[model samples]
Target: MTDPPKAWDAELVGKWLERRLAAARHDQAAADRRGYEARDDYDKAAAEEWVCRALQSPDCTREQAALARRIKELIGQDDYRATGIYDDIRFERHVRGHLRKLAKMTKANEGFEKTLRYQ
Candidate 1:
């Protein structure tokens, strides 16, 4: 019988998640600076779509999936109008919050190996 694929280590998944989140945030920031505003419903939809794609990608681990889900939810909640001046700021805040959570997860997983050694 064929063996099942091994589950990824939480620490490894956390690192991968961190990298993906950073890349996404950087891309969004660059786009924002270029006047590619995300204040409209269409833009929000596109952002949510991108998050959904990331979540469904084969490269996404469990940790990344969870983070992506939160990002998608944030995008859904964004009510910024095209006339608003704080659209970019609000979006950045959401991204930063999620990034912080990703960092925390990475730190928490750092000692995972020690605990598993006893198991």
Candidate 2:
């Protein structure tokens, strides 16, 4: 028997990809602007102030998330710095690399190379 009609045309796919690429480029520019804003001297002080204010929150709400929760226990018990932020709030960059590697290994991608071939 003859094959059924295609659900999607190749031309439609090309147009869709072109639009998506254009939108992605626009988003990249906006992201760069945000980075520049963060680097501004005024923004630096604001970031520092936010860190100082959240100093009491364990981890500065920073990288050591689980450990940071214990910070509250130390708040009134002993002499703790009232306004001090840990150097890094979210995490060390290495952790991100590890997470990305794990995700790539575990995530299903029809186009990516997998340990064993499967669609």
Candidate 3:
């Protein structure tokens, strides 16, 4: 016969799920940083424009660009903490933050998109 699962075990399982999600995000974030860091000036600029595409957030505003970047970092940080990956991971908030900041700058300079991917 099988025994019933304990509450602590269930909690442990929940923690494991959170940690897994965070670890995956950390890995993805690291890759994104490397990709951004490896580009030349013009490529980096264009890549920055692509990065803005991730903002797939409707209502994403020029003024909210910097703030949006901040929020994205916070959201990622919360993911790191929740997933217990912050200890072994050195997820630089500035990587994503700066990338998004550039995107925001581009949008602000170019004027808001009327039909962005998110729109």
Candidate 4:
């Protein structure tokens, strides 16, 4: 025979649920951090590869090559302010964006977009 069920402890159940939710939130925060770190590493590696290819490619124009070199130098450095340009920029994204625009205008056939695709 089965034993009779005990009454539910409302206060105890509430405290348990609160702890569970807190743990879930903490886990989510950790996961987000890991995702961000992974993306950063991927971007860095990709930027390095693209810079190398751009520097070596004959199809890359002089201006594009110069921009690529600059981006390569700035990849691991802290963000800086330019004398007459935008203030407080994320170097990688900013320089990368400029290189992309220049490549588009110059109709570069080096497959810049494919090189930086985040898989």
Best candidate (score: TM-score): 1
Error of 2 at 11 (Å): 0.7
> Over the stretch 7-107, how does candidate 2's per-residue lDDT look in tens digits?
32323323332343344344434444666543333222333233223332333222233223333333323222222212232222222332343233223
lDDT, candidate 3, 49-78, per-residue tens = 323344333434223444346446544643
Give the per-residue lDDT digits (tens) of candidate 4, residues 22-93.
443444344446775444333433333333343343332234445445445544455533332222233357
Candidate 1 residue-wise lDDT, 1-119, digit = tens: 98764444745554454455455545555556667454433333334324334444443445534544554554455553333334565544544454445445544444223322111
C-alpha RMSD for every candidate = 12.7, 18.3, 18.2, 24.0
Q: Give the clash count for each candidate.
A: 0, 3, 2, 0
Q: In candidate 3, how many Å is residue 2 off? A: 70
The candidates, ranked best first by lDDT, are 1, 4, 3, 2
- What local distance difference test score does each model get? 0.44, 0.31, 0.37, 0.40
Model 1: runs farther than 4 Å from truth? 37-119
TM-score of each: 0.33, 0.27, 0.24, 0.29
Model 4 deviation from native, Cα RMSD in Å? 24.0
Candidate 1's displacement at residue 119, Å, is: 35
* Model 2 ranges off by over 4 Å: 1-6, 36-119
Which regions of candidate 4 are displaced past 4 Å? 36-119
